[model samples]
Target: MTNLLSTSNQEEFGLNVLIIDDNEQITKMISSFLDMSNYECTVVNDGKEGLDLIKTNQYDSIILDLAMPEFDGYEILDALQRENPSYLSKIIVLTASNVPIENIQKFKELGISSCLQKPVDIDQLLSKIIDSSV
Candidate 1:
């Protein structure tokens, strides 16, 4: 198991992040990047598990994928909206899907901070996280 946070900078800025995606590669890649950047990260491979963690833990941000088996990102979003609206402010949707403009607008209405397409630009994502953390 990977260390969730870097002790090197936890005292200064312990940003905890949760990454929810069915793609193992994507989760690992993001986690590695965030860990190196001094952010604590927990990766979940399914939406259900992700939802559970969100309910029970505290995180500064969430990186979510819209497509997954067992429970898709929409369902997770809906659950958060209904059961824990505050979480909406911390989510950043990261999906490879060519989502419709209407759907993207709806996601914004649901209070997601941002919707980013896959093959994510690491610098942009890091910037978004930093901006949101403030």
Candidate 2:
């Protein structure tokens, strides 16, 4: 997993990914996998903190969980819609709850790159991340 790439090629392939989830284990697993895949990862457990980071830093992709405490994903999305709509294209929403079809459509309307359920396949997630970045 420590096979580092050349500095130039790394810049071409590596993406700065921010993963925001209340579940520590999920974040750790995703971050580790992305790190091994040559993507830099930042993990945030609190939605409020995650929102702050989203506002202050630029990341190539954001993996966001819809259910979280102290300012949930909807709040973050709403805030971004108001002030940072461009970032929506780089966001992949993940939720365990059974979201309504209308809400799912809303997500697409908001320009989210993808919406995935919990227990997502790592490979598919990686594919979405790559595709969205492209």
What global local distance difference test value does model 1 have?
Answer: 0.86
lDDT of each: 0.86, 0.87
lDDT by residue (1-134, candidate 2, tens digit) is 23334335555668999999999999999898778768989999999999899899989899999989878999999999999999999899988978889989999998999999988877678778877776
lDDT of 1 at 67: 89
The regions of model 1 sitting more than 4 angstroms off are 1-11
TM-score, predicted candidate 2 vs. hidden true structure: 0.89
In model 1, what is the error at residue 22, expressed in angstroms?
0.4
Off by over 4 Å in 2: 1-11
For lDDT, the strongest prediction is 2
**Candidate 1, run of 10 with poorest lDDT:** 1-10
